[model samples]
Target: MAGDLYPDHGVTGTENRQYNREQRAGKHEADAALYKSHQCEQTPHPGSWRRHDQRTQGPLVAGYGIYTQGQEILLTFSFCSSLVSGYVITYFPLRGRSETIRLILSDQGAKWTEEEVQFTDWFTANCEHKKQAVFGQLPKFKDGDFVLYQSNSILRYLGRKYGIAGGSNQESALIDMVNDGVEDLRMKLVRVLFYEPEKGTEKYEADLPDQFSAFERILSQNSNGTRFVVGDQISYADYNLLDILHVHLALFPACLASFPLLTAFSDRISSRPKLMEYLKSEARKNRPIVPKK
Candidate 1:
C-alpha cells in the first residue's frame, strides 16, 4: 500500500514509478543496468526490511519479486505495524496456535488482520460433506496474494523471512529443537485441556517442573545462561514457546516460581522495547489468550 517497492528500501513511490517509466522508455541504460545488477540485499532483521544492489545476486525489480506483483501483493518489506498490507489470518476466536503466529507479527511491529470463527461454523465450512477448505483446518493465513496453512509451517516461513531463525545454521537447529520441545509439552497440556478440562489446572501444575525445566535448560545453554532460548535473540521458537508458557502462567499463577531463570526470561521477552506497546495495547488485549469455553 505504501509504494511499489519496500517503503524504506530505496526510492519513494513517485521515484519508483519514474524509474519504472524510465526503464520502460529505454532512456536510462546506466540506471537500468544498475537496477539489474545492483545486488539487492535483504537482511535477516526484525521490524523492517532492507534491500539494495551490491553487484551480486538478489531478486531485483526487473529480475525478481516485490515489483513483479506490485500493489497486488506486499512481497517486499515495509516498516509498518505488520509486514504487509491486507494480511488476514482466519481462525477460531481463541489464542491457540494462531495466536503464537499473531504474536510473532505483532512483536515485529507488523500490520495484519484476524478473522475469528466459531467451531460450529468452521465445521460447517469444512465438513467432509461440504468440503469448503482444501485442508479443512482453521488458522488459514493470507498475505497479499500468498495464502498459507498450518501453524508451524507459517511460523517457520515467517521466521526464515524475518530473520527470526537467529541468522545461522546452528541457531536455526536450536530453534527447531526448542520448537519441538515446546510442541511436545503443549500436546501434554492439550491432552488435559481436551479430555480433562476439569483437571487442566492441576495437570498443568503437575507438569510444570519437567516440561518448563527443559526450556529453562535450553535458555541456560544459549548466550551463557541469559535470555531467550536460542542465540541470545528472539526466534520463531521463542514466540511459540512463549505462547505455551503464557498458557501455563494463566492456568497456574505460580508456574514459574521454581524456575527463576525462566521467570526473568519471560519478563524480558514480554517487555521487549519495540513490542511492549503492542503487547499491552487495546487491540492485543481484546484477543484473550484462552477464549471462554
Candidate 2:
C-alpha cells in the first residue's frame, strides 16, 4: 500500500525532521491561540469528555461539580462551542489516499494544515519520521496529541469526530461498507498506476464499467441516486467514493456516461460550497493523483 503512493526515493532523516519542525513552528502560535479559545480550560460543558492540548501536554476537563454536606451538588456546566482546534495530515504531495480525508475537512470547514512529505523523505533508510510510522507508511494523521496511521482509519476517525459517520449503528455500518468497497477499487487503480502503467491501463479501463456499476447500484437504492450513498447526511463514504469517481473521470471522461446516477452524485458532491472552493484552490491544484515517476 505504501508503494502505491510512495515510491522509492532518498533523502536524509535530519532534513525531513528539520522541514517538519519548521512547518510546525510556523503554525504553533496560531494553533495556541485557537486552543486557548476553544479548549476545555476556557469553555466547560456538562459531562464533557476529557481533551488534551497537544501543545502544552496538559489535561483539560469540565463538568465536575462541587459537593457540600447535606446540600445539593452544584454542577458547573455550559454548552461548549466547537472545541476541536485543528488537524494535521502528513503525506506526500500527491492526492492518493489522503485526498478523501482532505475533502472531509474542507467540507466541514475544519482548521487543518498539511505537513508535506517529500518522496525522498518517505523512502530514506534513516528517516526519523519514517521510523515513527507504526505501519511504515505515509499519510499519518494527527488530531491534537492523538496520532493515527492508515488512510482508511484516519477517514473513519474524522468521520466519527465530526459526526459524519451516520446517525445509527446500521447506517454507520453501511457507510463503512461503502468505504471498504471504495478501497477495494482504489487498490485496483493503484495497481494499474504504479505496477503496470504501460499495458495495465487499457485492461483496467475495459473492466471499469462493471466496477463502477456497484456504486451506481448503491446510489440507486437511495432516492434514485439523488441522496447520499448510505444515509441522508453525507458520510465519509461519500467523500471517499466521490474522490475515486473524480480520479476515474479524469482517466476516462466518458466513464460515467452510462451511469447517470453516479454522474449526478459526483456533480452534487462537487458543488458543495466549501468543497467546491477547495477543489479549485491552489492547494488542490498541481497535486497529481499519484507522484511523478
Output the number of the lDDT-best candidate. 2
Query: TM-scores across all candidates?
Result: 0.71, 0.73
Pick by TM-score: which candidate is best?
Answer: 2
lDDT of 2 at 142: 88
**After aligning candidate 1 to the native by TM-score, how far in Å is the CA of 230 from where it should be?**
1.3
Q: What does candidate 1's lDDT look like per residue over 19-125, in tens digits?
A: 44323434334433343343333333333222333221111121212332121112223322321346688887777878788778777666678776777765663
lDDT of 1 at 124: 66
Q: Which stretches of candidate 2 lie over 4 Å from their true place?
A: 1-84
Backbone clash count, each prediction separately: 11, 0
- How much RMSD separates candidate 2 from the native structure? 13.4
Native-to-model Cα distance after best TM-score fit, residue 131 in candidate 2, in Å: 0.5
Off by over 4 Å in 1: 1-84, 125-132, 198-200
Model 1 residue 91 CA deviation in Å: 0.7
